[model samples]
Every structure is written in structure tokens, then in C-alpha cells.
Target: MIDPRTPVLVGVAQFVDRDSLSADALSPLDLLAAVSGAALADSGGRGVVVDTLAVVRLFADSSPAFRSPFGSYANLPKSLAARLGQAPRRTIYGPVGGNTPQLLVNLLAESIRSGASDVALIAGGEALRTQARAQKMGLALDWSEDPGGEPETLGPETRLVSAHEVAHGIAMPTAVYPLFESALAAHYGDDPLAHRRRIGALMAGFTRVAAANSYAALPVERTADELITPTDDNRYIAYPYTKYLCSNMFVDQAAALLLMSTAAADAAGVPVSARVYLHGSADVHDMILVSQRLDYHSSPAIRAGAAQALAQAGIGVAELDHIDLYSCFPVAVEIAADMIGLAHDDPRGLTLTGGLPYFGGPGNAYSLHAIAEMAARCHAAPGSKGLVFANGGYLTKHSFGVYSTDHPANPARIDPTLLQAALDAAESPPFVESPAGAGTVEAITIPHERGIHGPATVIVRLDSGHRALAVIDTEAAALIDTQVVGRRVNLTPGHPINHARFE
Candidate 1:
């Protein structure tokens, strides 16, 4: 007999509000409450005696300046609990990261497996689209609520980027991901045109999935040619990345999951058909700084985490009937596919609910939507297994999960610290804050603003073998249409930033 404390996902739900112009558009809290109720209903009833209410922190909550124009909440988890009429014994507000959803699920599953908790609810939502609409229309929305209570916070609050990266203007995802893209292209030996077609084809598959998904924020499908060939609408955001290739974060979406022990599910009268077991799960992180990474084209943490999770499940990637690799960018999917040993043209498809770019990134909660979709698919095709990969930061954090309707013989086990320690032990290249003299360009990116050329950022390997960043003017950026890797460049350290000139 299986252990009574074995954790199982009872129900899942996803919501997307595209009618941003409506006055009745839901706030983030409203979306959370709605999805929470829907998820409970999906489990066949309402109250399940939730012991813990955990929330994935929103992107808007990262800074006070980005607070919703409607209003703000003091205690987000507690406020959400009041809306759901749930007074969980413990409320948890998770740290900011796209990986938080899956990480929280893994942690909560362990808690339930150990009999620390019986039932838990994990939910997250983003109303960025609605907020943007409100701001554009100069409309006032009163969503302010002060539900008093300090909930327990999960994960540390640390800056995602390093000081050196920030000083070189490589702070945001837009800038940082392109650096990886350049490196990946060079690693694959693909020319500018060939690389564009390759990624465009990959993302086109995701768009087709989104076109079929009713809850997708942008459901329109496009051909690979249309995706790669830049038009007035699909202008270049960064070198090798068109606007359509980026994750669509301006979306009003929410997702939630209801997790409980098998004993609790049975006690609640949940049908066996409605249960989806998490057979395996693991979380790990790569080197924090991109400059210090041993290889920009691949991620060690992803490979170890995927292998560990599959090992715990006593299965391999071939056994998975479905998969949803995080697709914030083409490189993210490519790197994950390589590490997980999955083919780009795998018959099973790379995503369930489209991908972050086509379906809507929805801040850090994007993977929650993927998890919800995977659960529904598993329930529909009983006995089949699915894998979901969640990524946070710049491929810096990773979490993997394998799910199936059939229960696992062995209990779920995960040791993220072990993998993290291994990654930490790996030697990293030295990063130079300032450098003089000649260097070779390791990677380069030229981002565009409003369809116009912008500054070019380059990662240069100095004569001493240390990596440093330099910015170039648009005049120099135009000359780097082809591969810039191995191109000789002269670096001049400046007060605010460093300048590089191609030789």
C-alpha cells in the first residue's frame, strides 16, 4: 500500500483576462481568489482544510515604484486568504522568481509527505495588462486593502544580477538573455540568418499550441518565416531576438494548484481519477553571475536537476508522455532541451499551454500555468507521465517535476543543496570590472528601442583571460551584423562604462 502521507495534486485551474478594457477586470488578488475557488471546485468540492496558503511573489511586488496603479496590499497572502474565506494556520509569501511556483510545490509536497501539513494551496496571478490599460486610459481603480498580519516569507531576498553586470547595463532580462543567445548561436555555428530560422521554428511550434489553448493571452499563430522575418510589428528588441520572440509579460493571467496528502484526498471524497501524483521533483541553481559562468550556451544546474528528478521517479525522459520546458526565450528552450535529452521535434511537443512567449509570461507565475496544464493533461490521459521545467532569473535557478496519474512506489525525494554545492564547486572564470588594452569579443548584443538602433553591449575576454563588458555606439554596432565572437577589439575603461572598438 502507498504511504498515506504521499502528496498528490488534487486539482488545478488557470484564468486569463484579455478584455482589459472592461471595467470589471479582475485585480491580481481577485484573479487569485477566482482561480483558488475554481481549483477547489475542480477537486470536486470547496473546503479541504488547507493548513498552508502559499503565494508566489508578483513582479510588481519587487519594487515599490512598480506598485499597481489600482492600489497595494500590505499582506498579500493574508489578503488573498480573506478573499477566499480561508484562514489557513500558516500563510507563506514566497520570494520573487519564476521558479517559485514549482519550488514551493516541491517544498510543500515534502511537508505533506513528512506529515507536517495535510493540505496546502499554491497560487499566483498577474494583472500587468489590466494595470497598463488603466494607466493608458487614466482610469482609477481602488484595489487597496490592508489585511493586517505578517506572514512567513519563503526564500531569501537577494539581487538577481551582480554589480558588474549592472554597471555594464546588463541588468534586465532583455539585456542579459541576449548575451546567452549570442553565445548559444556561436556555439551551434549558426550564422545570423540560420540562427534566426532555427529559433523561429522552435517558437512557432509554441505559438501553434497557444493558438489551440483557449486561455492563452495571445492565441494567434504565425509561420516560422513570419516569426523570423522582422516586420514593422515584429521589430528587433535585441540582436537575434524579435519582439515576438520575447516572453509576453503584459498579460492578465492567474493559476492555482490544490495539493493534499493521498489520505486527505480520499477523506475529501476526491475521485482517484482526479489525482495527479508528483513522482519526482528537484531544484537547483547555476552560477549567479553570467560573466562567471563556465559555459554560456548550457546550464549545469538544469542538467543535474533534471537528472535528479527523473532518478527519483525511477524513469527517464523517454518515459514522459508530455513535457513543458520553460520557454521565456528560444535559448531557454534550446538549453533545456539539450540538458533534458529531449529533441526539438519530439512528437510529444515541448509545451502544454503554449509557452511563456505565446501564452503570456504572467510575471514569476508563468510555470504555475504550465503545472496546471500538465495536471489536467495527466488527468485526461490516465497513467501517462508529464514533465514540467520551471526557470527563474537568467537560467540561474531551476526546478523540475515529473507527474503522473499513477502513484510512485517510492516517495518523492529531493536534495537541491547537493546539486547546488556541486555547481558551486565548479570552477568559474574570473570577471574583470575594468580592463585596458586589447581583448576578444566573446559575445555581443545590439538592442533596439522603438524600432531604432540602440547601444551595443559586448562581453570581451581580456588578454589575461578574464571577462569584461564594454558598450559600443550605434556606428560600431552596425558593423557587427555577422558573428562577433573571436573578433579582436580594443577596450578603454571609462568612469561610468567601458568602451570597445572593433579592430
Candidate 2:
């Protein structure tokens, strides 16, 4: 029997507009109320409102004149609480990261399982494009302006990057993901053109799925060639990465999920007919900084977390109907598919929210949209199971949740500490600071010396016909100016004319 205090995701909802026509196209408060109300309605039309409010941080739209006086952190919980007409027993504002929503759900589930509280709402929204349009039109749109201290920060407590990585331009999402992609490419010995095509094909499937999703912000389908081929319109942001291959975060969007204890749901007269159990989940972390990794092509934390999640649910890849593998870029999916024993071209397809690129990555809350979609799909498919994987902090933090129509075993828990310990034990190969004479092709970004300027990560493979992590002291201008990307260079020890490679 399920525990009376077992926390479950009782309802899920999402909202989006084809275009942000007005400043309030999808106001943060309105989105919260709509989704919360829908979640409540999904819970058998119960009039009961959420008693605990956990608001995800909303990123402000830079274009609009909207000052967001309360900052993205301060206004959401109070606004949601007012809309629900109930004083939350407790309120929390989370720190930034794409993984926040699932992390919040996990915490709420534990709270319900432990009887800390019941009937909670987890919600967030961003109206970026809408605000941008308003700025262009010179129209003033109404928004919350209350002020308060910043919410308690919640993210990796430690600095993932060392001073050296940042100094050399190893920061930012675009710069980081390409490093992994390049590593993946080198691992397979695929030429640049072939690798780009493979990634485009992988992401095309996600765009197809998004095309069918009514709430997808950018729902047009693109072919693999269209996505991967670089053009003036889609310039290369980083080596081996086109603009289309990156996550799109400029749209306005929001999603919310309602959670309740089994007892609380029953007491409120809500039926369990549509409930999907959070059967099992696992959260783990890899190296926080890219520079510390032994291998950029793979993530041990992702592999272990997915394994634990599937094991806890007593399921495997062969039995699953749908899977969302956190498609921030082609490399993420490629690596996740490798980890979960699913092929890149698995007939089941990889995404249900069209991946982050097409569906609009709404800050840290986008994966909540994936979970919401999974719940709806399971509810519709009867016995089918779905997986939602989330990532944060440059592929550093990962959380996986398995959901199914059947009620899960009572008192389920995932001890992430073991996974973390395993991650800590795993060793990444040291970067090659200097290599013997070998032919190399590389891309180097010479960042401006101003605030955080330097060439992002560059790849220099030894001519030994194998991928090599060529490291370098990037503070030297000679090393930064080399056009190593899409070109061949001779690596001679102590006689280098154009670049230096070593860590």
C-alpha cells in the first residue's frame, strides 16, 4: 500500500503564446494562477488551494522598460500566494539553474513523505519576448514592483571553475557545451562535416516533437542539415556549434506542478485516477569546472544517475515508451543516449518537449515543462512510463525522475551521496600541457582583457591520429590568436611559433 504521507505530483500545467503580443502576454502571476488552478482542476476539480508556495526564480527580460523592481526573486511567491488566497505555511525562492524545478519537486516529495507539509505549488514564468516587443512599441506594461531582500540562494555551494579556467574563457554555456561536443567528435574520429551532420540529425527529432506541442514557443520543424550547417544567418557561436544547435531562451513561457500527499488528496475529495507516481529518482554531480574533467566526451554522473533512477523504478530502456534526455545540445543527448543504452537513432525518439532548443529554455524551469508533459503523456497512455532528466551548471549537476501510471512502492528514496562518492572516485585524464611534434586542428578564442574576456576553450588534437587534450596557459596573447579551429597546425616542442598548448 502506498504511504498516506507519500508525496505525489497530482497535477501539471504549462502556458505559452505564439508571440508575446503584449507586455503581459503571459504574466508571471497569471501563468502561476492558471497552472495552479489547472493542476487543482486536474486533481478532480478540488476547490482546495495550495498551502505551501515554492516559487522558482524568473529571469527578467532585458529589452523591456519593465524594471522588475522586486527583482525576479522577490515578487513570485507573494504574488502566487495572493492569487491562491491562502497564506503558505512556508515559502521559498530557489537559486538559478535549469535543474531547479525537479530539485524543488524532489524536496516537496520528501516533505510530503515526511509529513512536513501538504498541498504545495511549484511554479515559474518568464515574459522575455513580450517585454521586448513592448519596448519596441513604447508601451508601458504593468508588472509587479515590490522590493525585498534576495531569496536564499540554492545551487552548487562550491566554485566549479578555478581562476585559470575563467581567465582562459572556459566559462558560459555556449563556450562549455562545444568543448564537450568537440571531445565527442574526436572520440569517434568523425570529420568536422560528418560530426555536425550527426548532431543536426539528433536535434531534428526534437524539433519535430516540438512542432506538435501547442505550447512550444518556436515550433517549426528543421532538418538535420538546416540545424547543423553554418551560414551567415546562423553564425558559429563557438567552434563546431551553430546557433540553431544551442538552447533558445528568448521566449516567454512558464510551467507549474501541483503536489499533494495521498492523504491530503483524498481528504480534499480529489481522485487518484490521473495521478502518476514519482517512482524513483537520482541526483548526482560531476566535476564543477570543465578544466578539472578527465574526459569531456562523457559524464560519469549522468551515467550513474540514470542507472540509479532506472534501477529504483525497476525498469530499463527497452520497456520505456518516452524519454526526455535534457537536450541542451546534441552532445548532451549523444552522451545520455550512450549512458542509458539507447542509440542516437532509437525509434522511440529522444524528446517530448521538443528539446530545449526548439521549445524555449525558460531559465532553470524549462525541465519542469518536460515533467509536466511527461505526466500528461502517462495519464493519456495508461501504463506507459516516462523519464525526465535535468542538468545544471555546465553539465555539472544532474537529476533524473522516473514516472509511471502505476502506483509506486511505498517509501521510495534515492541516496544521491553514493552517486556523488562514485563521481568523486572516478578520475579524468590529465590535460596535455605540451605535446610532442604532432599535426593539430584547433579553434582558439582570444578573449578581451576587460571583464572576463579571453578565447573560450580550444581543442588541439595530437597528429598521432587520436584525440588529445592540448592544454595551454591562455594569458599569453600568442596562444589566443591562433585560428586553430577548422585548420591544421604543426605542434613542435619548444619551437612553437603561433600557439602554446598545455595546462
Q: Largest lDDT belongs to which candidate?
A: 1
lDDT of 2 by residue, 355-457 (tens): 8889888766888899999998898897788888888777887888888878886347777887798789876545444455555544343333322334444
* TM-scores of the candidates in the order shown: 0.97, 0.85
- What is the Cα-based lDDT of residue 213 in candidate 2? 91
TM-score between candidate 1 and the true structure = 0.97
Off by over 4 Å in 1: 473-480
Which window of 10 residues has the lowest lDDT sum in candidate 2?
494-503
TM-score of 2: 0.85
What's the CA error at residue 244 for candidate 2, in Å? 1.5
Off by over 4 Å in 2: 61-75, 136-139, 147-158, 429-456, 459-503
lDDT of each: 0.86, 0.72
